[model samples]
Target: MALSTNCWKYLVLTFNALFAMSAVVMFGVSGFLLYRLFVYRHFIGVNVEYPAILLLMMAIITCSVAWIGWRTAKSMHHFHIVLTGVLIFLVVAVQFSCFVWAMVVWDSVDIDIKNSMTSFFDVANEVNNPNSPESIRWDRLHVQKGSVPFSCCGQGPLDAKFKPYTADCSTLYQRGCAKPLHQYTRQQLLMVAMAALISSVLQK
Candidate 1:
């Protein structure tokens, strides 16, 4: 059956809107990540990961979709509509999943940091109290640094006592309080891989 001109125009317009939105979202997210990696070098680190690569891939896919949509606008076709629809759905799903995973990891890190902080404070208060039992002090000496530092009690010039104050600080806090942040970043990298997988599946 021959497609009506009005029907074809509507299809092309819809495709254009969908692809354009996808392209903008992908580009914006990828660019933001890249900018963060560059500007906040310590936060994102120098090493590349699967998530970073996947974000880049998503940006490329979105651009491709935009291009195809533009072409379709010039010459609408049934096949183009089907292709665009499938691509839009797949890309959107992947993007949404990646975003959700990122948020989850981000929140996990926050909770971990908060818990670590609470533990550090409890140990610290025990250590600071003069009337506290010698046993409590002994126990506090064994506290290792946690993933995030509640206070710089065991860092810098004070770190000299970290070995003796092990109970007051977690190994994570002692070694470098940024370890959990690094883990959070690594999880973000995994999200990029997820996005890449989606892009690959969509390409198929």
Candidate 2:
């Protein structure tokens, strides 16, 4: 038992620096994304901003709690040791909550995207006056990524394109963007959430 405790002590000491470094990087990146999302919110939708905010919060809390844990671990006081354990428990709770939140977000992403696209087109299509600012912006958006225009016909695989059969629906990725994209996105994020949950549990 003594040997195991000593091993953990040294490991924490070794990793505390790395933890601090990683926290700083996460904080910076998430903060930047949260800030920039405002400008591009209209283009991609506001779905991204919320996650960035969540990420920033997690980074700050994790880093702060980790430092307290490290400090309390090094202390000889019984109270400090108890505080350390409590802090670790709090981290585990937060991680679990984050995992749950991520899954919920995963389920809603497709619906959110569909609504955003629908709302955008309703206002963007200045078909009667192609020279209008909205029409110009809509055309510019389409040209930005030819693959995006060609990939999905409408919101989902079952959905038909708003217009008649075109090269976009006939030739390129024969499906709606929503289902496949949602599957891909959820798969990626699930892995991340699982990793984070496992890491936090292990840390505890």
* Superposition-based RMSD of candidate 2 using all C-alpha atoms, in angstroms: 8.6
TM-score of each: 0.44, 0.58
lDDT of each: 0.54, 0.59
Per-residue lDDT tens digits for candidate 1, residues 29-65, read 6666655444323233344433454566677777777
Top candidate by TM-score: 2
Error of 1 at 130 (Å): 38
Off by over 4 Å in 1: 1-4, 7-11, 14-18, 38-49, 107-204
